[model samples]
Target: MKYDFDEVIDRHNTFSMKWDCREIHVILGITPRFDEDTIPIHTADMDFRCCEPIQRALRAVTDHNIYGYTGVFPGGYGQTYYDAVIGWFKRRHDWDIKAEEIVYANGTMEAIRSCIEAFTEPGDGIMITRPVYTPFTGTILKTRREVVNSPLVDREGNGFYEVDYEDFEAKAALPSTKMFLLCSPQNPTGRIFTDEELLKMAEICRRHDVLIVADEIHGDLIRRGNVFHPIAKVAGPEGIITCTALNKTFNIAGLQATNIVIQDPALLDTYRKNANFVLPNPFTAAATVAAYNEGEEWLEQLIDYLDDNIDFVIDFFREHMPKVKIRRPEGTYILWMDFRDYGLTGDEIRERIYEKANVMLESGPQFDPERGEGFERMCVPTRRSLLKEALERIAAQFPEG
Candidate 1:
């Protein structure tokens, strides 16, 4: 590998949300019983360094020492930024995108909120699969929209999951259901929606006049043998809005850059009008251009390392903690672990990890109380040594397993 993914830089004083356990607990409402040095394997951000190209670009910007307001659309370096975005989709995802169809937002979540606000009305229903990324449900509730959860079937023996199409269609057919937020290569479960699945979902939404919001933020991190089918390609552009960002791929999330793609002109006009308050950051724009143009090789290497780390975690669990089960992930660095065999409630698992193991992991219920219980989300984008330490700590506490 050309890049050093094993290198660990100190993030303690960097105001990292993951490293700051006290703050994370306060935000997530997990009161800590004991405080000690803890390794945070929670949150989606990686422990690895940002791609070299992006770091160099940010350093160059800092060296210039002249930070002032800069234009973002077709002015100065803005066109280059836009072209990078277009070129990336064509090169990576095979989706041809136009400049006018792309709108800039500060981040994926911010863009999602804007879409919820623009496309759906208060008290309207937004459809999602349970044991999904928590923020999907949180954003819905925050916007005063009702959350319509279509729970995925467990496929128990293999630890894999599948959508219950029957239930999904039933929810979409509802009169108040206005939109569906599809998390491709979905969080927690890590199942990449196949093209057939995508088409089926598109069919249901179209018949019910529901708009589809595809959150493909983790699309590029897909594992080997799995294909990430972009919803717009199957559903057509008429009622689809796709959100993506370089933050996850290149690890430049602190820069706050995301692209919200809308193919329909009339819908684009409405979304932009509703999200009019968004402003572009000059440094982040520069970093984004650098990432798209020069960071592909680094990204490729990072994915390889992340895949290896996932394997390590799975092997460790199977050998030492057989009671705990994991379904091999198809995309994203986050691994979903099922601990139902341990006979522990979600809070009990959280307590053991936080109080005894001294590691911070995302509790199951935070994703969905019913479906997410007895499951934990572990971020595995760190060095193998650190990852092993976290696993060892947890295994030591559950020795009988």
Candidate 2:
């Protein structure tokens, strides 16, 4: 069955965090005065519907109508769930994973917090790349750990970013730095680290005794012709805790199911002890089983549509708003845009985009307090027509001189 990627779904009254939540914007320092006509392209989740198989799985669960306590323990659903996860990774990424290595979590952030508690002490430094996902910083700080930032250097002065290896080694070597929170196929910037890069970073952490927590939720969302290597695959599984989830890939984040892969027994035991006991949601279990086993066709088609949407934005910006620098992302549906050429403060840019243009965008400073000025992260997973309209509205706000 062919899916319609062009269909525009109305998400206004569905309690969507991206659409209905105006107070969240105000809390995040964005203007909250958008009317009903406003378009939001900030949140990372897609506006697309889940695949037919996943929908069918959820309906089956609903039909059962038994919402009792459930789990993926041993018999019954356990083997099926594990087999789906293992098969998906083996087939898609060529990385073989064992059933024993998989641990369940409510969400990726929750898993990260548990890792922090289980591994590091309070006041220990957790390293991250700036102009990164804001939640990484928030999670580290909220866990009472110091945030050691190794800012990604855009050496070309274009939007492309490279790891400053020398700086990374220096931070890892710090006695206070106990862990490295890595974002593979990194967020916002969208650069998938090469094997050599991954190995170098992993080696540094191993030598410095820094625990490595790799967030690989975006592993399967690579743009065409690009590949994403699981850091655990590149840098051996020891001392590495890999976070994987079908939520991002299958557009089922609200279901809140995440798989934390720990190949080392010691690390796995420690994580389990510290991590909250996440009782499996029946709907999430059904969704994951179907998604991993049968949703590949839909995923491939979705990627093609997403790829076109990305190119459309790149072309639209180049033609209409040339000063707004953007490059095609190698992975993820996010586009990290540089707005420094306009010479406006981040707040001014946000005001114009939110108030005048009435299009909601994630402001740069939310990702990085210092270097993220005059930048914005746009999530481009909506219908192409709506995306074009949003871009045109934004272009009207910032006229080309």
Candidate 3:
């Protein structure tokens, strides 16, 4: 209650891709069948106001007004940003990492793309889950490597997605499959992976010599009762590059910053060599340092608000939309709602809901082709009142039986 979860902030006219993207709004009108303006909850960006401390720091940069060419890594934002992540790993996760092991990049997306390019050759194979963050597929394909799918299998009402271990090992062992991207506190599902699961995954990738790219970007967002483990902590640190950022946790994603931690110096060097594609600007550093250093209190408050939103969502589904099921995610503000019982195709459900209520949600198909069909990702970082209103609208879209 300390943070205002019911507060509404306007994101339109702010150059927000989620809010201001006219093209997507038009396309959405086709499927989700929205009017010119819709309540968009489809994209991953948070609707909350930017963390105040980060805004102050960016303002400080503007006041300086130098705006010259900036150096990458080991300066300004890089120095303090590195310390913050190191502190975070030690404080929250109980994992200690050397500052030298951490590499800087524009963001996790760019870092993953560079990792694919650096770790594998053309025609090599990469493995990732479908119904996953869409960029992972394109990043690997851009490397001219084949992407192998080990779709996350949902069994009955388990309310979680699991990889086919046999298929994973087989693909990893192939001479072609050279890397595997793991999204922990996974998006959509919000499942904080078990230690046993991460260990098994790391072992298979290790045995097959496939580099492990663990995207623990949501690690900092884990709830109080659950623990979010970094894969490298259990995997014993060989050929593992950990990609994470403060953007998701603090809702400062536009800061354009993230860290890539690789234990092996040689591999880290090669990754840096291949990562010349995008250089982060100074504001990225300014906002990042501000986030890591002074943003903890804000983050804690945000977490509490999100938990309330989660509770509200569950209540709404149970009372008004009983056909949809949720897993009560342990981390990540994203929720994966299962509507398989309704027997509507993901697209059908999405289109119908949007057409009826003007509420936009991430349809399941974007995560993967098969497993994603029954689910939708709803981000709960916005105002609880708005989230409630949106869910009610979505439910009203379904005609009473």
Candidate 4:
């Protein structure tokens, strides 16, 4: 409770993609059904203010006042940057990595794109689990690579998803499939892959010589009781490209900074030569250092607040809208709610949420064009009052018979 998460800061007119971008609807191919009163709980970014240390770091950068080209190691930033990143992983995740193995990237998606380009050629297959972050598929297709989807299984008929190892191995065995994009502490479903699961997937990929790019961007945002295992830690460091970033952890996605960890010397060299060189801006460097080092207290508190928020949503839905199927996610602040019990089409569901409830949520179809129907993803990092209000509005529109 040191940081005021309840404080509702206005993000309007801030050029925020979630709040200010009217063009987002068109971009997402969503019909403009929402009015100005619609509460947006769609995007993955947090509405909460970043930790104080990050703010202080940025302030220091501005105080210095010379916005010039900044190198990674210039002005003694190398040791601090490396130490913060190294210390954080070691201290928090118990995963030890070297500074030399880390490559700078602008963002997780950008890093993934670079990995796809560097590791796989055009017409090559990049395997991914659908009902996932849409960007994974988009990036693969945009780069002219084949998207080999081995859909996650919802065995219990609940929202919780598990990797289908049989299907995964079958897909990995494909001669054309050259890489696997792994989203640990996965988005949407928020299923934190267990060590067993990570190992099984890694073994399959390794057996088939399919490279693994583990996007651990959401790795640190787990629920209180759950543990997250990095793929590199579980499957050894060789031939695995792990992408880590402070953006999602600190609600600093706009900063566009990420570290690509490639422990294999040859793979690292290939990535460095193929991937675009991303220079670290002064603000980004300061924020990264501060976030990895001094932002833990704030992050812990934030996780606690998010846990409460998740509980609130679960309880509210169970009481007011029992037909809405949702499982408690192990990680991330997203709730994947299944509304198929209502017997509404995806378009109807969209209309009900956007027009009737005046709540903007991510439609299921956006994640997986086929299987993601009648589902919606809601992000819960806003003020509790706003979240409550949005839930109430949604519940009113979808009253139980």
**lDDT digits (tens) for residues 1-401 of candidate 2:** 89998997999989888888878877877667655898988888899999999999999999999988879864565899999999999999999899989988888888888899889999999999898999999999998999999999999988889889899999999999999999988999989999999999999999999999999999999999999999999888989999999879999999987999999788998887776778778998899899999999999999999999999999998888888899789999999999999999888888889888899888888888889999999999899999999999999988762
Superposed Cα deviation of residue 379, candidate 2 (Å) = 0.2
Quality of model 1 by C-alpha lDDT: 0.85
Off by over 4 Å in 1: 31-36
Q: Can you give the TM-score per candidate against the true fold?
A: 0.96, 0.98, 0.93, 0.98
**Residue 330 C-alpha lDDT in model 4:** 97
Candidate 1 TM-score over all chains jointly: 0.96
User: Model 3 over residues 234-331: C-alpha lDDT tens digits?
Assistant: 76788888997877877767776787888877787888677674556778877777777778778888888778778889888888878888988889
Better of 3 and 4 by lDDT: 4
lDDT score of residue 54 within candidate 2: 98
Q: Could you list the CA RMSD of all candidates, in the order they appear?
A: 1.6, 1.1, 2.3, 1.3
Clashing pairs in 3: 125-176, 130-367, 131-367, 131-368, 132-367
* Stronger candidate by lDDT (1 vs 3): 1
Using TM-score as the measure, name the better of candidate 1 and candidate 4: 4
Q: Order the candidates by lDDT, highest first.
A: 2, 4, 1, 3
Which scores greater on TM-score, model 3 or model 4?
A: 4
The CA lDDT of each predicted structure is 0.85, 0.90, 0.79, 0.89
* Error in Å for residue 238 of model 1: 1.8
Best by lDDT: 2
**Deviation from native of the Cα of residue 32 in model 3, angstroms:** 5.5
State candidate 4's TM-score.
Answer: 0.98
